[model samples]
Target: MKSNKKFYMVREDMLPNSIVKTAMVKEMLAGGEADSINEAVDRLQMARSTYYKYKDGVFPFFNAENMNIINISLLLRNVSGVLSSVLNCIANLQGNVLTINQNLPLHGVAYVTLSMSMEDILVPVDDILDKLQDIDGVINVELIGKS
Candidate 1:
């Protein structure tokens, strides 16, 4: 089982500006946005103090270190809007979709691969998959990779 405990890790060079930007980018990225804190900070070249000054002001949603992501695969019926429902389900479950790939449906079957991570999902992942499979158009769900 994955730990739900919260912990903070800061490097010697991590300043307040760096921290704030890092936190913001992290939050946005977790919501299916692009570019992590490292990318934004590296792009803006902001100091650590600036980040720290507005850290509490920006977002209060920061939970814990969330780099460990899981990759999943699924088989679904070749029908309209099924993928959207799956994406919505992931969001409702508090899981962030990092990457997605879907193969062309032939003979009414589609293969989907998703990479995601959940910073605060308390529900067991097995239950999550079962719920996804229970979707009207979903045929099967599987966890293919995790790290």
Candidate 2:
């Protein structure tokens, strides 16, 4: 199956009343301003059905920009200096590391997942992957999210 969905960024002032109200309701819920959906809807004077219909579909523009966050999973040989080498390579490329989670080495290999921002990276995603793959102890480097 193919996805035909498309997204656009528009000014808040240009949005319809329902969409704006839905956003307010979402904020109320997230900020604990309202105890429940019913309370939020009542406080915002918006129908509960309307809030549900658009809550999942609408997000602040800043969040859309955060789509640049990339998740990379690596399989590295369980040996000294292997992980350090990977970090150095990423640092050289100017990618900003956000979060890293790694599993204990087992059976001569360790699984590592890293979330980083590519906004300031000097090289393209493919180039970074190529360099990572070329590392001596890096058995695999897989891009796990949108690049």
Candidate 3:
């Protein structure tokens, strides 16, 4: 328990060079360009000391925490700007809309299907879904898949 008393943290600005090197190392590893850390450090013009400073904690953009991608379905009140409201909700959630499909409005309702990235969302799915369900002009909202 005593060992847990000490916590380690790295400030973002303190290791500027090392942070950049860490990204370079990860890119090299992904492209099958470097098999060894020494090679990666040399190829990216990074020092072994910099690599050691941030190696374990740094990762490239491609390795972001996209644990899962999910699909969503929204019921919009078939009216002008109604779809826009749904889109605004997605933006508020920081969701990246990959695809969207809207069918012809039938019975005053339009069904929509959206594929979005939830990796950087600002809120949990249930909360977003609930808020969407409560939005004006949004008749219904449901996550079709893991979204």
Give one clash count per candidate, in the order shown: 8, 0, 1
Give the range where candidate 3 is weakest over 10 consecutive residues by summed lDDT: 1-10
**Candidate 3: stretches off by over 4 Å:** 1-67
- lDDT (0 to 1) per candidate: 0.75, 0.87, 0.78
Write the residue-wise lDDT of candidate 1 on 60-146 in tens digits: 343424365778899989989999999999899988898999999989999999988865576888888988998989988999977
Candidate 1 lowest-lDDT run of ten: 57-66
TM-score of candidate 3 to 2 decimals = 0.54
- Cα lDDT tens digits for candidate 3, 6-48: 4345664665776877877877877888998899998878888
* CA shift of 113, model 3, Å: 0.8
RMSD of each: 9.7, 8.2, 7.4
Sorted on TM-score, best first, the list reads 2, 1, 3
Q: Give every collision pair in model 1.
A: 15-48, 16-48, 16-49, 16-51, 16-52, 17-48, 17-49, 17-51
